[model samples]
Target: MKWASDSITAGQITLLRVLFGFLPVLGYALARRALSRHHARHLHHYFAMSLLATSVFYYAFAAGTALLPSGIAGALSGAIPLFTFVCALAFLRSEPVTLLRFLGVLIGFGGVLLIARPWETTHGVDPTGVLFMLLGAASVGASFVYARKFISPLGIAPAALTTYQIGLALLTLMVVTDLDGMTTLADDTRALVGVVIGLGILGTGVAYILYYFIVETLGAVTASSATYIPPVVALAIGWLLVGEPLQLRDGIAVLLILSGVAVLRVTPRSGAAVSPTPRWGPR
Candidate 1:
């Protein structure tokens, strides 16, 4: 997204992401005959999930990644597990909210503040970009809980669930996205390849298939813990590939955020449940 943002509108990037990502997933669904087995009555759930997960998530990500340094943007996204735990506590009755998890949330936000540096008026992370990334993280976080609460109960296969979500997201993007100037991306080889191969196929398509499978097996909050890995990876990529400078705060922030996620994953020994792992399909 950072690579392509300079060449096209965030809306266009988001639209293409869903469009391209949907193709391979759609093909897999056809091969497995997953779509034919989908429950029509649950279409609304799929739409809602797609709206939050893909549409809002990708748009906010594109917009934020355009302004912020890639490392900071990714670190901010590491907060997804925090938001997921909070949402689960509020909405998921079966979700266990232990003191350890609460502490983890606090520790995670501490890292976020280090990244945002709202105290510094100048040279701080862009407030607008931080807000957008946070919105994206929150949307994805909520989607995790929502999926656990609603989608997992349907017993849909992971591939079919991903197909429904991505398919609807593609349709939604088609309605709202403008095609004008989108073709300008053809001139930038790096951006084009990054968007098509990196973001679309690998990031969105393949990632979500594995994600929903994890969600089905491990539960929402646990599945969301996967987000913590991206911050360090992004920081490394930003420095090595994009030549973005890394700061001391970035390393510290990544450490804190990852530690928080680690804490959240450790189940309490006080007999409290960790997270509700729902079996939607055969494991």
Candidate 2:
């Protein structure tokens, strides 16, 4: 996605992401006959999920990645798990909070401080970019909790949920996204392939199906732990592919953040066993 940022607008890329992503999901739903309409009561929940997880998250992350080094952007996104934990504690009545979990949250924020390096404002991170990344992270973080709380309990099939979320996102983007420079994406083969295959088909399409399955199986907080692995990958890609310089502090920060995830994972109270299994929703 970072590679494509220069050629395509963030909104256009996001629009294409869901546009392509929704195809397979819609196909799966049709094959399984899971295309039943959602209840009026749950309609709002689906909208909220789509807005948070798809619309806001895709655009914000794209914008942030465009402005900042992919490494820094990915590091900032490491906060997703922390924000998920916090949101779960607040919204999920069954979410247990152990001392180790609390400590993990602290450790994760410590890493965020290191990544931010607010004291080095002269050449420090861009505040706007950081804000965009955090907003994206928090939005998806909250979406995890929201799905677990409102959507999962209703037991919507993962394929159906994914279809609805991506489908709504695609429609929303179509309405608001400016198509002015969209054609330019085809001009750069690498960017075109990255946007279509990398971001669209795999990242948004297959990824969300797996994500929603995890959300249903393991609960929200645990499902969000999947995010912990991306920082290292992002840092490595930024250095090797983009030639972005990395410092010792960057490594340490990523270490602390992953360490936090490890701690949270080991905390018994934070285990997936604590998450209730999905129940079948109403017909």
Candidate 3:
């Protein structure tokens, strides 16, 4: 979101790139061995591939955001829970589509609309950016579904899966990023440091670890529900750190999204049983 608002210095962008590039690898490595010992090899492979795909898509999404509107980017992100729910219903037998789940989806989307305040924003927001972010959200939802079906069943360690995923992403970025773009890093130490510290450790490393653990324990549908938290987090961060004023709509959106998620949480778990094999896995 911040990246969409203003031009991030080369150092800052690099820091974010590096952190996002490598943190998941550390998390995955921490848990990989344990997971390998417990789950089937194919399952591990699925987890690795899913994580890699997600990481790649995230970079694409972020880079795309640099060209799009922040409001659109945020609105697209808010669709994650709905997409996850749809993916779960279509691909994962363990997650069923109940009325309450549908209601949660409605509430969540409504919250996103409120948070985005698209109506209030001027008409200059790029439609392309909104599509790109939505695509990213869809990719993430698919990843979550796969993780729940394949990774969770295998019970591979979340840290290990995260490590491999991040490592793969880092490798991909190293191969694809323009070397010339990196020269800016030497000119701005503070920005570079901030990017590395904030994005790498906090956003990519720690956040992914928490995400994987949540996915492993709660299943994909429940785990993906956490998507609602980030908007609130971002809003609070902006208000406290940058002196941005909070709006009434933001509060209403939070209430709606949280209420929707709460409704989903209180709903009974699906009675359907899922097979452990990859072929039977969620998408």
Pick by TM-score: which candidate is best?
Answer: 1
Off by over 4 Å in 1: 270-283
Clashing pairs in 1: none
Query: In model 2, which residue pairs have backbone atoms overlapping below 3 Å?
Result: none
At residue 256, what lDDT does model 2 achieve? 90
**lDDT of each residue in 141-259, candidate 1, tens digit only:** 99999988898878787788889999999988899888999999999999999899889999899998887777877888888988868889998889888898899988898889888
Ranking under lDDT, best-scoring first?
Answer: 1, 2, 3
lDDT (Cα) of model 2: 0.83
The estimated TM-scores of all candidates read 0.95, 0.92, 0.72
So what's the TM-score on candidate 3?
A: 0.72
lDDT of 2 by residue, 159-210 (tens): 8888888888888999999999889888899988888888888988889888
Best by lDDT: 1
Q: What's each prediction's clash count?
A: 0, 0, 11
- Put the candidates in TM-score order, highest first: 1, 2, 3
